[model samples]
Each structure stands twice: as structure tokens, then as C-alpha cells.
Target: MLKTLLVQNYALIDTLEIDFHQGLNIITGETGAGKSIILGALGLILGNRAEATVLKEKSKPCVVEGTFNLAGYSLQDFFVDNDIEYADLTTIRRHINPAGKSRAFVNELPVTLSILKDLVSQIIDIHSQHQNLLLADGKFQLSVLDSFTDNLQQLASYRDSYQKYRSLTSELENIKEKASQAKADLDYLQFQLKQLNEAKLKSGEEIELESLQQQLSHAEEIKSNLQSAFTLLNADESSILIWLKEAVSSLSKISHFFNPAEELQARIESCRVELKDIAHEVEMQNERVLLDPAELEAVTQRLDMILSLQQKHRVSSVDELIEIREKLDVQVNEITNYDQVVSQKEAELEKITKLALKQAQEISDTRKAGSKKFEDSIKALLTQLGMPYADFKVNFEPLGELRPQGIDRVTFLFSANKQMPLNDLSKIASGGELSRLMLSLKSLMVKTKGLPTIILDEIDTGVSGEVADKVGNIISSMAKSMQVINITHLPQIACKGSHHFLVYKDQEKETTETRIRLLTSQERITEIAKMLSGEKISEAAITNAKHLLGSELN
Candidate 1:
């Protein structure tokens, strides 16, 4: 329930503070007396849009704050979810700067407008005359039936299944699309993989092939050099090895007579042996260096193939080409296995679809059963609200496909006369009838759903006399369960409230402001008299106001 509203520097409200009470709190004033301004201020705290134009002083910010008593409401989870401090008396405040910047706060903690709206919606409902159009809305009608049936848990389950079904169906479609696209590229991938496999690639093959090609290309020059070296060392008559052996023999003859001669003979022998080994290696190399065009062509072809593969794959080495081959192999394998993957996804989708269908059927059946009870209850309430011949029904139509709400489309039908056939509420119900119907629906909702607070803004606009009294009685009855605030011009409704408040303009030297005050019993009588007669209060009007107040009290 709302406890207090404070407005500062708001439109036509320089500074105002009002305390609200439980039960039907009636607010009354003449037209243009700033009654709606209070509601507007309340709307701001409820997370409605704010503008710089709403600021009374262009240099000052506008502030609207509301205090709510949340002792019995189970909203601790909401506070924890939003990371806000919760108290038994929670205050929500809104501030709009001169630059049109708006900010919201919950318990002095900064919050987003969405969070503010969500928290406020759970605690208060502001129903204006414009909201009567919701009576004809199909979603709203279905919600009414659901509320009456207490099928929120079931609806939640159905929605969960529906979401799963949708996700799996979407996954199946994507897999099928992937398979279709992959099929187009399957043959090309296979050909590439087969080419790579037949190449028989190896690491470092290019470097080895290049070295072999160089050796084969210069075979004649290498053979000529090796033979020349062998001839100089061993095959010639005055070879260096022959001279070194003769020096070794000479040194060996004197080596027994002199120590230096022995060392010299050893050095000369080592040189002769090394030269003989060099000549042998040269001779072998000369024999093996014969020019062979077949071997040259084979090495050249291998090098050319390595270069061609590197260029074809846009890589710098055989290693990169090998990596591309591995990737292509995986792609081919996946294509081969796509059919099984798609079949598995399709099976999963079919299972979820069946489950969703069953849950939707259960939900539809519950709605069908609740709809009859809802229609009967609303018709009875409408009759009590001065629509004695009113007829109400819930019309269900089959949907072409499943939806989140289910497979049924609901419409509310109404007829205000006995002989009239039921038609859509929008086409048949007048403004007054719509108002009464909205009240009837709200009254029924109170019995089913535990509403926190409801504020009716001039719902009694087109109603008066005994019907107005009945409207007052209905609102008064609703207040028994929760807080109900009715802003009205009818004395009958005004007298029905447990507490009365009057909104009027207070003009000072240079500024005019709107103010509200709780009316005492005598003050209430005087206000009701003014509403009964308007502008001029007569003795009979006062008597009638007292009698009406007395009757409502009884």
C-alpha cells in the first residue's frame, strides 16, 4: 500500500506532501484543480517519462517520491536480484533535472527505469478511463482467465517447453542448411584431398632435391677436377707423394745418428701417408662423378613438383601444404557424417515438439475450464453493476500454428440487452458500460489475485445517480481486501470512501501551487455538498450529503 507522496518543484506543485491511507481514499476537486497533477507526480515515481517542461522552475530539478508499506509483500527476492536495500517501508524517488535528464532511486540506491517500473508494478496499479479498452484485448482476457484458474505454474511450464521446441527446430533448420551448402562443395574437397594424398609429401625433401640437382648439373667439371688432383698426387712421374717418400728414406738413414733426424723422418712419413689417402679419395670421387642425364632429369622433376605444389597451395613449404591436406581430410569426413548428425537433430526436435504439444493441450484445457467460470462470474458482477441484461462470453478460436501462449485465440464477447446477440466488447459496449465492465473485472480479480493497491482515475466519469452509488459500493467492497483510491466527481462515490482528500489551488503573491489535504468529517460533509450541488452549497445539499455519508458508514 502507498504511504506518502512528496512532490517538489513539479508542474503546478512547488512543494506538496500528502499521506495516503488504506481502504477507499476518495479525492475530489473541481475541474482544473490539479487533481491529475498529484497522479502525474505519482506516475513519475512509478517510472513514467519526465521532461524539463514539468519543472515549475526551469533552473530547479523536479522531484517526486513515494513511500510504500511492504510488510506483507514477498519482495525480498526482487530487492536481492536488483541489489537494492529493502525495508518494510520502501521509498521510490524520481528526479528530473533542468536539462531533462531523469534518474530513479530505490531506497536511495540508484536504479534503472525498468527496475523501478517493475518494482512499482508489483505494488500498484493505476487504472484510468483509457485502460477500459483493455477489456477487449485478447491477451488481457486470457490473463484474466488464467488468473482465475491459478494456472501460472502450468503456463510457465508450457512456455519453457515451447521455447525448447523452438530452439531445437531452429537448430535442425541450421544443420539442414549447412548440409545443403556442404553437399555443393563435397566433390571438390574430395578431389583436393586425393591429390594431396598421391603427392606423398615429406619433410626437407625440397632441400635434398635442390642439392642433388646442383651436383648433377655440374658433373663434368667436378669429374675433371678430381682426376687432375689424383694425377698430381699419385699418377704423375714427379708426384709430391714420391718426393715425400724419398725425403722420409733419407731422414730414416740418419735418424740413428742424430735425434733431430729421427723427428724429421717421422714428420715426412706422416705427410706421405696423408697425401696417399688424399690421392685414393680423389680417384674414387673421379670414378663416381660420371654425367648421367636420367638422374639429372629425375632430380629436376622432383624439385619442379615440390615448387608446383607450394605455388598451388599458396604456401612457402611442403609442411604448409601438408597442413592444408589434413584440414581437407576433416572436411570430407564431416560431409560423410552429416546425414547422421542431421538425423539426430531431427529426432531431438520431434521429441520436444511432442512434449510442447502435450503441455499446450493441457494449458488449453485448463483455460477452457476456467473460461466458463470466468464468464459466469463476470456476468453476475456486471448485472450487479446496473447491467441487469448484460451477457458475457469467452470465444475461443483455433490458431493455425503453436504460439507461446498456446494454440488458442481468445476474445471477449458482450451484449448489454436481453435480445441482443453477443458481439465483441469494442463494438457493442458504450463508454459507461466499459467502465462498469472494467470495475466488474477488477472486482473479480481481487478475489483471485492479491493486488497491492489500485488507483481509479475518474472511472465514474459517465456514471451517476443510483448506478454511481452501485459503482461506489463496488469500489468500497474492493477496498476491503486491498487499498483502493478513487478520484471522482460524484458525491455518491466520494461519500463511500473511508478517508476523503480534497485537491485545490493555492495562489500566493507571484506563484500558484496545487495542494492536497485530508478532510475531517465536517469538512467531508461540506466537500460532498459542494460536489452534490456545485459552486453554491444549499441546505438540502448539505442534508443529502450527510444522509449519504451516514448511509455509507452504516
Candidate 2:
């Protein structure tokens, strides 16, 4: 519940602090008495956006702060989970500097506007004149029903299972897509491998074939050189052997004069014998040097095949060709076994999806039942709020198959009179009807959702006289279970509050200022009387205000 609210330099409100208590707290004043200003200031502290235009004279900034007591609530647990401080009391404050820069703080620790919005919404539900219209929204309708049924734990479980199922289904599709793509690539790879394999290519075969071709191209020149060497060794009619024999005899005759030549004669004969053997080997090689045309044709074909594979694959070396083949082989294996893996994933996803669908359907059934109860109770409330002849309906639009929210799209249907058919609430609900309906629903929601406070701004805007009184009573009944704050123009509604505040504007020093005062019992009578008769506080208005108070006491 809100313990106190403080506003500084906000709109006509230069400085104001209002303390609140249990039960209905009503604020009343004349039409332009800054009553809505109070609600707007409270809104700022509740994470509503603000502007610098609200700043007062001599004030560089506008500030709105609220303190709340989270008694018998799980708010502290939320703070703990979010790693925020859970003080004995929580103070939410907002400041807008002169330049229109805005900031918010929780427990004096600055936080982002989004964080303030998320946390404040959990604790306070500010249903202004327009907020009640959200009741007709489809998503909000589902949420209200779900909240009544306490389906958070179930919803969380179902969502987890649904997401897992979706992920697995996506994975299965991706695998199948990859398998199809890989199969096409595998076919192409196999064609390439067949071409390479049939070529019977050898590593370095290009370099070796080129070297052999050079020798084959010059075969005639090589044969001629070999013949010349053969002639020098033994091919001529007068060979070196004959000349060496004659020279050896001459050396033998001179050997008697030189002893060294006598030893040299034996070595010379050894040399002549080694030369004859070398000449014989050379003659044999000369015959082998001539190339065969058939053998050359085979070599040329092998070299051509290797060069073609290199050109097609764009590889300069045999090592690179081997590496590509290894990669293709692995890809082909994965493609060949793709069906088995995809089948397994599909079965897994199917099993989880069935389980999730079953759970979602169960939740949907429970939600429909809860919606019926909610509809009946709220209709009962509206009947008491002077719409006894109204009809409330919760209609379900059938879905052919199961979805995340089940097989139905829910809507709130309503008919203000018996002569009318039930229509979509958003299209048919009037502002006043929506206000009462929202209050009734919120009254129910507060008890179930454990929301700490409910603030209704201008709840009785269109209501008057007796209808306004009944609206007050209905809101007061809700206040018995939760703290309720109302901003009202109706005197009848203002008199029913357990606590009353009177807001007014005062002019002095050529400047207008707004002020808020907690009304004592006597002050309450004057304010209530003023609300009843406007500027004229006649005896009759005071007497009627007293009767209204007396009726409230009853």
C-alpha cells in the first residue's frame, strides 16, 4: 500500500505531501482545483513519463516520490531475485530536470525507466478513465483469466516444452535440407572422383614425362654422339690398340736405360684391358638408346591424362588433389546416412510436441472454466452497481488445431440491455460501463493476484447522484480487502471514503499554486458540501452531504 506521496514543482503543485491509509482514500475539489494533478503526480512516481513543463517558478526540476510498505507480500522476494535492495520500506522517486531529462530511483538506487515500469506494475494497478478500456483487449482478457486460474507454473512448463519442441523441429528440417544439398554435391564429387581415378594419374608424372620427352625429341642427335664415341674406341680400321702395341715395344727397348719404364709396362697393359671392357659396354648402350614409338605413345597418353585432371580441378600439385578427395569422402558419408538422423530427430520432436499440446489443452480447459466464474462474478458486481439488467458473456472462438494458447481465441462479450444481442466488449462497452466492469474485475483480481494497492482515477466521472453513491459503495467494498484510492468529482462518492483529501488552487504574488490538505471531519463536511453545490456552500448542500455521510456510515 502507498504510505505517502510527495510532489515538488509538479504542474500547479509547487510542494505537496499527502499521507494515505487503509480503505478508500478519496480526493475531491472543484473542476479546476488540481485534483487530477495529484493523480498525475502519483503516476510519475509509479513510472509514468513526465516533462519539465510541470516545474514551478524558481524550481529547476520536478520531483515525485512515493513510499510503499510491502506487508504480507512477496515483493521483497522479487527484489531479492532481481539483485536489488529490499529495504524495510521501498521508495520510488522520479525527477525531471529543467532541460526535460528524466530519471527514476528505487530505494535511492537509480534504475532504468523500463525496470521501474516492470516492478511498479506488479505492485500498483492505476486504472484511470481510459485504462478500463483495456479489459476488452484480447490479450488482456486471456491474461486476466489466466491470472485467476493461477496458471503461471503450468504456463512456464508448457512454454519450456513448446520451445524445446520447436527447436527440435527446426533442427530436423535443417538436417533434411542439408542432406538434400549434400546429396547433390556428393553426386558431383563422385563424378569428379571417377574422372580422376580412371585417369590412373601418378604424382610428379608430369615432371618425369617432360624430362623423358626431351630425351626422346633428341634421340637422333644422341645416337650420333654415341657412334662417334664408338669409333674413337674401336670402330676405326686403325684403332688405338694397334698404335699402343707399337709404342709399348719402343718403350721396352728404352726400358733398359730407365727402370721406371719397366714397371710402367705392366700398368700400361692393365689400362689397355680396362679400356676394352668400357668400349664393349658403350657399344651395348648405343643399341639400347634408340626409342620405340609404341612405348612413347603410352607415356604421352599418361602425361596428357594427368594434365587434364590438374586443369579441371585447378590444382597445381598431387598433394592438393589428395586433400580435396578426403573432404569429399567425408561429405558423401554424411549424405548417405542423412535419412537415419533426420528420422530420429523428427520422432523426438513429435513426441515432445504431443506432450506440450496435451498440457496446453488442459490449461485452456481450466482457463475457460475460470473465465466463466469471472464472468458470472463480475456480472453480479455490475448488477449491484446499478446495471442489474446487464448481460456478461465470455465467448470462445474455436481453433481447428492446437496452438501455444490452446485451440480457442477468447473474447469478452457484453449486452447492456435485454433487447440487444451480445457484442464484442471493445465495440459495445461504454466508458461508464467499462469503468464499473474494470473496477469489479480489479476487485476480484486484487484478492487473487495479491496486488498491494489499486488506484482508480475518475472512476465515477460519468456517474451522478445515486449511481455515483453505489459506485462508491462498490469500490469501498473492494477497499475492505485492499487499499483503494479514488480521484472523484462526485460528492456522493467523496463522502463514502474512510479518508478524504481536498485539493485546491490558491493565487498570491501574481502566481497560481496548487495545495492538498488531508480533510478533518469538519473539513470533510465543507469539501463535500462544496462538491455538492460548487461555489455555493448552502445549508441544504451541507445537510444533504451529512445525509450522504450518514448513509455511508450505515
Candidate 3:
């Protein structure tokens, strides 16, 4: 519950502090006494947009600090989740600086306004007089019903499963798409493989065949040239070797007479032996040479075949063709296996989808059952709140597709009179009916959600006397389990408050300021008297106010 609110230079409030208490705390004041200003400042702390005009002294900043006491409420988890420190009492502070900067803190730890709002929302609900759009929301109606029936755990589990299932299904689809594309590529690869394999090719065979073909094509000419060169060197008549042998014989006989002639004869014999050896080697090489036209043609044909295969495959070497064929074979094999894998995955996805649908249907069915009981509970409360002829129902429709909230759409149906048929609650419900319905639903939510504070802004907008007393009584009952702050003008509701604060304006140094003071029992009686009689506080109004206070105390 909200413990203390301190405002400085916020609108008409200049340095005002008000402490709150548990149970129904009512704020009563004159129409323009700045009662709503306090709520507005509180709203700023709740993440509402801050108006820059609230700055103080026309130059200084505005500050609004609120301290909330968590006590035994379940706000500890909220603090833990938000990384906020919390003692037995938690303080939430908000400040608006002169430079149009707004700052907030939770338990003195600086935080954004969104974090403060979320934390505050978990503990308190501020209901203004405007009709609640949440009431018209189909999903919200279903949620309220589920919360009323204690189906939170089941609903949460179901949603978690649904999300997981959706993720897995999406993964399966992506994998299948890639696998299908791979298969198409694989088919193209298989065709290339077949074309490459049909050509019987080998590496380096082209170069070997080309050399053989050139040799065989010129074999006759080469052999004729070798024979002619051999004849000129040794086989011809009057060859140089024959003449040198005779000269060497004559020179050897006269060597004793001349030493230079003896040395020349020896060199001449050495040259004769070398020349004979050379002739024999040449003859052997010439004998080995052979030429055949048929062999040349065969070699040429083999070379042409190898080069043609190379051009057809666009490979510079036969080795590359072999490599390409191997790669294509692997691709074709993968394509053959792809269909089986996809079939397996599809079957598995279908099974998981079925399980997900079953779970969602179960949640939808549970919500419908809860909705009936929820409607009955509210209808009973509405009767006590002076809506005896009202009929309310929770209508459930089964939607086909899956949503984050599940498969059913819920709507609230209502009829305010006995003969009227039920219509959409938002279209047919009046402000009073909406207020009472909101109160009843809030009362039911307290036991489920465990919030400790609920503030109603002008809930009794069109109510008075006995009806206002009933609204007071409902809020008073809620205060037993949680603190309720009612902003009201009705004396009946004001008298029912366990704690009362009166907001009024006063002038200090010719400047108007709003002040809030906690009222004592005697002071409350006087305030209630003013509320009962408006501008005139007659003796009868005082007696009536006293009696009303007395009745409320009893």
C-alpha cells in the first residue's frame, strides 16, 4: 500500500506531505481544493507523461516522492526481478528537474519510469471514472475468468509449450526448403557426371600419343637422312679413314729419321679407330629406325580423341575431369537420400503440431468453464451494489488459428433491465454499471493476484445515499485484505474510511498552495458535515453526519 506521498512545487502543491494508512482511505475536499492534483502527481510516478509546467518558483524543479510499504504482500519477487532493493518498507521516488528531466528511483536505486510503473502495477491498480477498455478486450475477459478459477499455472504451462512448438515447426520448414533446393542442384550434378564418365579419358595420354604420331609421320625422311650422312663419313669410296691408314703406315717407317713425323703417325692411328667406332654406332641407330603409315594414323586418332574429350568437358587436364565426376556422384547420392529425410521430418512435425493443438484446446475448454463461474460471481455482487435486474455473461468463441493467448476469444455480455437482451458490455453498460462491475471484478482479482492496494477515482460518480453506502461497504470489505484509496465526494463513502485525509487550499505569502491533512475522528465529523450540506453546514446536517459516522463505526 502507498505509505507516504511528498510533493514540492507540483502544480498547486508547494511542499506538502501526506502519509497513508491501510484499509479504505478516503480523500474529501472542495471541488477546486486540488484533490485531483495529488492523484495526478501519483500518476506521474506511475509512468504517465509528466507536464513540464509543474516546475516550482517558475525556474526550480518539481519533485514528487512516494514511499510504499510492501509489508506481507508478494512484492518481494517483483523487487527481485527488477533488481531493486527492498527492505521491510519500500520507497518509490520521482523527481522532475528544471531542465525538463524526469527521474525515478525504486528503493533508492535509480531506474526508468517504466520499471517503476511495472512494479507499481503489480501491487496497486488505479481505476479512473472513464470506462475501462480492458473490460471490452476479449483476451482480457478470458484472462480474468482463468485467474478467477485459479488456472494461471495451467495456462502459463500451455502457453510455454505452444511457443516451443511453434519454434520447432518453423525450423522444420526452413530445413525442408533448403533440402528441396539441394535436391534440384543434385539432379543437375547427376547429368553432368553421366556425361563426363561416358568419355574414357586418362591423364598425360594426350601428350604421349602426340609425340608418337609426329615421330611415325616423319620416319622415312629421318631414316634416309641418317643413311646418307653415314655413307659420306665412312661407307663411301675414297673415304678419309682409308687414306689416313696408308699415310700412318708410311710415316711410322720414317719415324726414327724425324721425331715430329713419328708423333703425327700415332695421332693419325688414334683418329682412324675413333672414326670406325663412330660409323658402327651410326649404323646401329639407323638399323633401329622403322616407319609405318598405319601406325602413324592410329597414333593421330588417339591424340585427337583425347583432345576432343578435354574440350568437351572444358578441363585443361584429364585429372580435372576425373575430379568433377567424383563430385557429381556425391551430389547425386545426396539427392537420393533427401526425400527420405524430409518425409521423416514432416511426420515428426505433424505429431508435434497435433500435441500443441490438443494442449491449446484443453486451455480453451478450461477458460470456458471458468468464465461461467466468474460471471455468476460478479452477477451476485452486482445485485448487492443496487443492480438487481442486471444479467451478465462471459461469452466464449472458438477461433481456428493459434494466437499468443490461445484459441478462444472471450467477450462480456450484459443486460441492465429485466426485458432487455444481453448486448456487448462496452456498448450497453453505463458509467455506474461499469464502475460497479470494475469493483466486483477487482474484489475477485485480489484473492488471485494478491495485490495489496487498489485506488478508485470517482467510482461513485452517479451514486448517492444508500447506493453510495453500498459502494463504500464493498470497498470497506476489500480493505480487510488490502488497502483501498477512494477519491470521492460522497459523505457515505467518506464516513466508511478507516483513515481520512482532507485536501484544501491555503494562501502563503500571497501564493496559493494545496494542503492535505490527516483528519481526526472529531475533525472527520466536521468534514463529513460539510460534504453532507455542501456550502451550508446547518445543525441538521451535522446531526446527520454524526449519525452517519456512528453507523459506519458500528
Q: What is the TM-score of each predicted model, taking all chains together?
A: 0.83, 0.72, 0.67
Best by TM-score: 1
Better of 2 and 3 by TM-score: 2
Indicate whether candidate 1 or candidate 2 has the larger lDDT. 1
Predicted structure 2: clash tally: 0
Measured with C-alpha atoms, the lDDT of residue 69 in candidate 3 is 80
Better of 1 and 3 by TM-score: 1
Pitting candidate 2 against candidate 3, the one with the higher lDDT is 3
lDDT of 3 by residue, 133-234 (tens): 678887777777877877778778777777877877787788778777887677667777777777666667667777778778888887898887778668
Over the stretch 162-216, how does candidate 2's per-residue lDDT look in tens digits? Answer: 7887789789989988988888788787877666656555666678888887677
